[model samples]
Target chain A: MDTNQPRWQRRKDARPAEIIEAALTLFVDKGFAATRLDDVATQAGVTKGTVYLYFANKEELFKAVVRETILPNIESGEHLLADHQGTWAELLWILLERWADRMEYSASTGISKLMIAEASNFPDLARFYVEEVVMRSRKLFATVIQRGIDAGEFRPVDPVMATRAVISPLMLIKVWKQSFSLCDTEPVDLKAFARFHYELMMQGLASR
Target chain B: MDTNQPRWQRRKDARPAEIIEAALTLFVDKGFAATRLDDVATQAGVTKGTVYLYFANKEELFKAVVRETILPNIESGEHLLADHQGTWAELLWILLERWADRMEYSASTGISKLMIAEASNFPDLARFYVEEVVMRSRKLFATVIQRGIDAGEFRPVDPVMATRAVISPLMLIKVWKQSFSLCDTEPVDLKAFARFHYELMMQGLASR
Candidate 1:
């Protein structure tokens, strides 16, 4: 809207985010292997040449989409973990609540789907995502579970397995909603489902 | 080697199955949209013309892969449900055991990954897969849960939601093994994880 500003400078600033958003939609819709970079550029309202200016290739663009959409949220999750002072159960409940609010309901959730779907095809991207996103999220859960066990607030178990059990249903439901929920008539209330899972997991983890 | 069998008759019977198997591998690797029918035909040691004799199109070949690999196992599951006379917990545990044994260590799990990855782009295939595969599997769990609730053997809970909860971790772990498990150094013991999940869920569902 700034008529006086240089067009190249304005386009340069906005294209990366705009292109990333468009690419995420395509990747989520078409999947990584099926999606074409030229189509992504077209969808983002830019030329293929223009798209190449920001990303060197399709893989780089794919990487940018994952990095741009998911990494910020992961960083904030780390911040939440560092700053939180609460019951471990409450912290987990809150952490998952934030995950649901931030990632599950948005385009970012597609990053999770894309990684799960195409990890074998793109091992390097998958490995990077694990290192950057999945492990960080697991550590958040594992740390809280460890805290709970150390504080005599929860029963002893493998913190890692406990973390997997706690998160599996949540991740399944999220992926199910995006992928298979469309074909089902009886819908599971996701918010209530999350609440119930938290309660059930807490009960299972409770110190006897 | 059955020397008595005619060559064309032998090739005719085996080619369809071989084509389906090769298609599953390609669909799992390259995804539905990117996988060419020609490559699948060649991989199966047949001409594109021969492939067309069995399947009408690439989508049909994809559907055949799913049908051949998954449908028989689902039928057996349905038969197990029909034949079972046991506690719901036992039945549920048994159902998951069969699922893990049949699906987790095989290429069939890749169908799950392909469906999730490509569902948005191919809603018809997704819907068909749901009708043919997912609903049947969910119905197996739902029926067991409903029977338990009706007989007062388990606590009252939404059978459908509870069924979703029961299958969630099993499905998640299967998909995770195919996808992210390669990157993980510390592998979760899947058998122990399944047994523990069953126990935890039964504890939650216990009426006493």
Candidate 2:
């Protein structure tokens, strides 16, 4: 042990991250209403007081967990869109694929369910998630669509509506997978699904 | 009040329906974990014993409410599909449009949130919803797609996957509207949105 290190240094910076990870797992498994802070403390292998040092209460802990886990995921998609340039269809497909991947593994789905359950009472959290995460992601997609339209890589389309068109099916697929665990029935080749969605999105439903 | 009905008839039939209706409104507003049977009775203007006479517990009341509200909505869709015929694109647009209309005002969205929150703990309810509602709806869409494929209204396509593609976007739109209330800022014209979705569903991304 490094005895000379300050007390703050002794508690590794990673401890907060680790605590959030543990909290999310518990929240997803037991739900926000049912999960106790004691359980999270035990799961994180920290004293209850130590847990309190980082979070004021269970609701605060949940909000922190959601902010830490989901916001970055959406930001990463924005980062990708900013860094990459491709055909409109290709760019949209990449974003959709990334979204599907995130929903498949992340605790965001569970957090979303918890938010939905509590939104009538906790409208603030619902509004925060929508404004901070959902709308942010939608705006990013809309920007990409507008860019594509300007470049003539895509038709002159309503970027906002087009973004919804591109993203909504993927969102539904995630809900289906979460609500039904359809992922377990068989390995859905997501690449194929992505391509299928992309094709439907760019063209009208008319025979040549 | 008309008390001419047989004692068993009112207790067995009308009372249960009333209790379930009251439960649905309470559950939609307060959520499953927070709502009490006493609240349901108060909301219905009935005695606590009247609720217990119909439902064994809160869970039973929830299930009964879900069954009563959702089953009829789904059955109505089935009836609509059975009585109508058109081009695959036309029929799908109509079905999805009707679905969007039905979900707009129904308590199903709130119930769905509750189901997702509790599904890990109550897997039976989740399974019941998936099997009873989701699978059945998917089958109906697949039947329409198959008819389209046979009639040369659509290019050769996998009806199951096509149905998923056709319906998934609409489901996502519903989640977006209900969960985030995104439509408040930019209200989606459901008819036009459904038409756009249907057109995209029938065609691929390639330029005509």
Candidate 3:
């Protein structure tokens, strides 16, 4: 590994990435307000000056972490729509299950909780999350619903409304997990819940 | 006002309530950690020692506010369920609309945001909210669903699952109000959304 690296190559981009990774962990653990730049430097095993060289302030560093780490996961979720060739209900289920899987990780939960706590004070961060992450994801789901309505695979539902119905249940799982702190020890059985929710959403209260 | 006051009427309970009311206003404006007891005293037109005479610390004062102001709202909500006799859908709509109204209030938003920021460190507060507030509400809603199922008004859906379905869409409103700071200027058109949501929840994606 040493033989492959030139002295110039070693100093290029690795330090910034390392600093961000360390800062993310600290921010999640102690929260953004509580965690300081010196703490990030200590966690990253770098000098305060070196950390400052990469990022100007704690807010800037935190934003970079959000952009770098969180945004990529959302970007990758776009791929779920590409292979969606099944019935709208089938596609909705698959997408919801995929979303639940993504949400199951600790890093995602930590970031989400941190965002909820801080988003009020920092409107720009909240806007970035809504526009970049939430609206985009909802748009993808809405497109599938629109296709379903056009094809007569499902009822003549408002695609936007239907999209919210399909998405909201999965979204509430995060609220449920955090609010009640249920399923802390065990996994939430999200697949079972997803299937049940999908069935309830598809069929009306009136018996066929 | 002073001339009308009896010696027994002007008591400790009166002063404590006045202090709590002032503290709630300050805490809502400046946040829990940011608002000092001195500010509360000034707002109440009392000395700081007088404020301390009623409550031991900031946490106790906040708990008192939650117990007095917020918890009563939940109790009145329960009474709403008891007072009204309607179809499950109608009852559910009423309950959700009331919740949306509360979320739209600025003071409620401030207190809830403060709670989210502090809940990680103050797990007892979180647990109290879940057990006292959320679980009771869920159970009440679930009972309404069960009654609907028994009356053959709804299809044979699992009442617990149906309750989750009914509540899930409203979560979007709460998240939008709190996390994104939307729906603050005016009343959210919850009835329209509720109608749209409940229709899809009952009948599903199939076009009639």
Candidate 4:
């Protein structure tokens, strides 16, 4: 709805985002191997040829979908860490809260679940994700954790290992939402779970 | 190895275990939908008919594989909790250590990975796993946590949510081993990871 730009130019710019959105949904619903570019095109209301104009193949589209949808959350989390004037524990809590909020509502959250399910069949893509997304995300966390230690706000636990402890429950929640929680008559209270986990983590990390 | 029994009788008794093992490997390798009875029989060194005699179908065979291999670990863990007179922290650490040790050496560890990947395709199987394995496993952790709380050894966190915090890293490690870690030149040290996580959890849960 940006009338400032020429209609054709605006449409051209919007197409890739639309395609990525469509592809993300399909990849999450169907495993990565089973999702086709044609299905993504149809879902995006673009022709199959249009999908190719943006992405060379399904694999590229999948990667693009991940980068466009999931990586921004990490970027913003970094921004929160950089801009905040808060206690390390409070910053960690806020970061977890923001993450849990996004995960509660985002279709992109299913990407991790999809990747876990299909990564075995696509080792190259898996490696790309581990290097690009997983490692970078862990670094973002490790940075905050290290900051906490340097400030003498936290115990000097190994930041690398502590990062795993912090993020693993979040990762599990995402996967569970897509898989087993689908079948649960009384599904997990994700908000309560996240809050409790954050409290426990901060308590453990607190310097005596 | 037992000479007290007839060789044929012993062989007949061993066939089900062999079939379960074969089915588990196939399920982890090829996934449930793609694995066939004939292939499993071949892996077990039995006829397809012999597999059929032990298990009515693929679902039954998969369930038996889970129950036969994974449940005994849980049972033994339960026994540890029941017999332990140690501090709750020590008991929790031992449970995690035992669980991690089993995961390090067991092919059945792959069952959770296989289930996570294939669960959406087989909802009934997923539901069965959640109700049987997932819930049971959580209950085992919760019981220990509750005992700790009642004995004034730990803080009063909700046992179920705390249980998720305890188990999520273990679940993430299992899935990671099957998926992303396949490409890692430097694989995780499972023992060190488990040790750090246990230390953190107990520290967090300890009452002042």
Whole-model lDDT values for every prediction: 0.82, 0.71, 0.71, 0.88
Q: Which stretches of candidate 3 lie over 4 Å from their true place?
A: A1-3, A6-13, A175-188, A204-208, B1-17, B155-158, B182-188, B204-208
Tens-place lDDT digits, model 4, residues B1-208: 8889999899999999999999999998888989999999999999999999989999999999999998998999889988999988788888898888988889988888788888888999999998889888889999999999999999998898889999999888988898787876546689899998888888889999
Candidate order by DockQ, decreasing, is: 4, 1, 2, 3
True contacts kept of each: 0.60, 0.50, 0.48, 0.69
lDDT digits (tens) for residues B46-68 of candidate 1 = 99999999999988887788788
Say which prediction, candidate 2 or candidate 3, comes out ahead on TM-score.
2
Give stretches of model 4 more than 4 Å off.
Answer: A1-9, B1-7
> Comparing to the true complex, what docking class would candidate 1 get?
medium
Task: Select the stronger candidate by lDDT from 3 and 4.
Answer: 4
On TM-score, the stronger of 3 and 4 is 4
Give lDDT: candidate 1, residue A148.
92
Q: Is candidate 2 or candidate 4 better by lDDT?
A: 4
Each candidate's TM vs. the true structure? 0.86, 0.84, 0.82, 0.96
lDDT of 3 by residue, A24-133 (tens): 89987787778999999999989999998989888789888878876775566566667666676677767777777776774655666677666777777767666666
Candidate 1 stretches greater than 4 Å from native: A1-19, A33-64, B1-11
Clashing pairs in 3: A155-B205, A155-B206, A155-B207, A202-B204, A204-B202, A204-B203, A205-B202
On residues A28-126, what C-alpha lDDT tens digit does candidate 1 reach at each position?
877788789889988999999988898998888888887887778767767877888788778888878877676446887867787888898888888
Leading candidate by TM-score? 4
